[model samples]
Target: MEFSAADPGTVRPGGRTARVRAAVLRAAGDTLAERGFAHLDLADIARRAEVGRTTVYRRWGTVTGLVADLLADMAEQSLPRTETGSLLGDLKANARLVQRTLADPRQGALFKAVIAAATCESKTAAALHRFYDTRVKEWAPCVQQAVDRGEVPAGTDVHEVIRAVSAPLYYRLLTCGDGLDEAAADRAAEAAATAARAGVYVLG
Candidate 1:
């Protein structure tokens, strides 16, 4: 099943399998955050998760598979999009969520590890793309609603507009050492809203 950032309605089987998956994924996240993707090892992850190496190797097969599953689980567990009845408000909410996630020491490190791996790993890159696709789809409706309310022009690319709200925040994380703050999130929101209203995101 394709994992989604919005509630994808947990198709994962429950009970022991779910418990093992959760434990494994959590351990994988911790390893990525602390050691980077280059150092990720299925045996190490199994040890960290307190599961048998045979189970991890049998289930995931490779480090790439484990990382892909971890990202999928993350997308599944991600918070749902916030609806605030206004484009700016919705964008701000989205931006703030991104900021908070990237600003956290562990989460930020984990993302960095995945991104680093994605640079050289096609499979990891594809999984990363899917993760963002799911997140964008989750928030795209907010911009559509804004269009319906006449806040943006017809044919505006709502998904791109929503993505714009988070772009600068992500850029800052990758490029600068500055602290991510609420002000930055609000500014990102305002800029995206202004750009959308000015037809910048309007599809040609």
Candidate 2:
């Protein structure tokens, strides 16, 4: 079914399929945020999504499968990398994005719940890692652009540098010892920029 965003009921071959997939993803995200991975069940997701349990089982086969697909969808929907013509600006954009998401009460709790699940569940952990990999890949180009502009070393590990920019924010969120605020975001951006310029992120 063809599922066009413009058509409400195109009745194409993939129309219902796309709608059901979107519904399941939304339900999965809601359940993950609300109850964590332990309580996540395909049946519960089906009910929440208003899709049939048999359909969910037939398609996903397992909760882990559903989670994996959900992560993929999230990665697709994530914002693209920013290009502000400077390492500091690009890093600040990345940091601000992390801070905005981490600082929101609901989003913060949701991330904590998901990360906690990832720690014990191998499948969930892998999915979580892939999710970050996708996001990092999306933003890595910004760092590369900075390198092209001579803002950082040409041989700098762009992906690693971008990942470093968000590492401390995630650390603070998971630890619950400090707030992930604008000031914290600024600090992270500055530190990552300075370190990258100093060859800290360059490979031998």
Candidate 3:
């Protein structure tokens, strides 16, 4: 997944401001990955970024705001969905992308910290929801293509099918503590494809 600026209108591209934002965000990600959310301090983040404390405070306002912006950046930077001309292929690509991200030490730790924080923070929850929504929407077209090609029922809930492909991978990440291997990703894609073909995701 890739990461973007907080507010488009307020953001100017290709300047010292952009550099500062990038530095601060990188520092924030490092802090979260290394120490988790409970220890994320804006002042320390500013120090790590070599930015002024007042700049961090005036720009982000609070830890929650900083995190929310960070999530927005992540959503914006997410890779575009792959087009494989087949639902299973596209879904496997998506699953592998998710698996690779979850298997990386730094990225996995960063996501864990953010997810843990979202459990009790409304803003964080909303940001997390938006991030997933962006990803799902990016890949949902593959299921729709399958429907158009008569591979699945016309009434299939495309978004749900896309969601299903990554659900198990995330479950394993959060619960089973198993390695997110290519086999797991392929299994997730195959299961979701099978379910879609079987009309399991069809809407009444």
Candidate 4:
């Protein structure tokens, strides 16, 4: 499970504005990973990004605003679903991707900070939900393809199956101190694939 160069809080797009956005977002993620969300300051972030503080404040009025943009950039930069041509393989790909992300120290810490911030802020919470929604949507087609191939029951909740694959891994990240490993990723993928095959995700 190799971590991506760009995580959910990191995005590198083309052009000047995109470049500034990526720099600022990267600095923001680094800050959050190091100091948590409570200590996030726009001026400090600007300094870290080597961008003008006025530019950051003018573009993003608040920390939450900047976080929202970071999340949008992350979704924009996230890798597309891998088509392994089979449900199990596709799910394993997805699981391994998630496992690597949570296993990375910086990404794991940044996500923890963002999730903690979301717990107390409505706007941040909404943005976090949207972020996960975008990721789930990106992978839902794999489940749909599985259905087309007669691997799962019709009317299976594609979103549920996808979420199921990541739920336990996240729980482990947040709770257990055990390192996120490839074996855990494989188990998650297998469990989700098994449940999907059993019609556990079928809508009533």
- lDDT values of the candidates? 0.84, 0.79, 0.83, 0.86
- Where model 3 places Cα greater than 4 Å from the true spot, the runs are 1-13
The best candidate in terms of TM-score? 4
Model 3, span 1-204: residue lDDT tens: 212123221343678888888788888888988999999999999999999999999999988888888877777776678889988898888888888888777777788899999999998888888888887888888889999999999999988988898788778878975868999989999999999999999999
* Model 2: lDDT of residue 56: 98
Q: Which 10 residues in a row give candidate 2 its minimum summed lDDT? A: 1-10
TM-score of each prediction? 0.93, 0.89, 0.92, 0.94
Residue lDDT tens for model 2, 25-105: 778777777788788899999999899999999999998888878766666666666678888998898898888777766
**Model with the higher TM-score, candidate 1 or 2:** 1
Q: After superposition, how far is residue 121 of candidate 1 from its true place, in Å?
A: 0.4
Superior by TM-score: candidate 1 or candidate 3 = 1
The model with the greatest lDDT is 4
Least well predicted 10-residue stretch by lDDT in candidate 3: 1-10
Candidate 2, residue 186: how far the Cα is off, in Å: 1.2
Residues 20-57, candidate 4, lDDT per residue (tens digit)? 77788889889999999999999999999999999999
Instruction: Please state every model's RMSD to the true fold in angstroms.
Output: 3.4, 5.6, 3.5, 2.3
TM-score of 2: 0.89
Ranked candidates, highest TM-score first: 4, 1, 3, 2
| Steric clash count of candidate 4 | 0
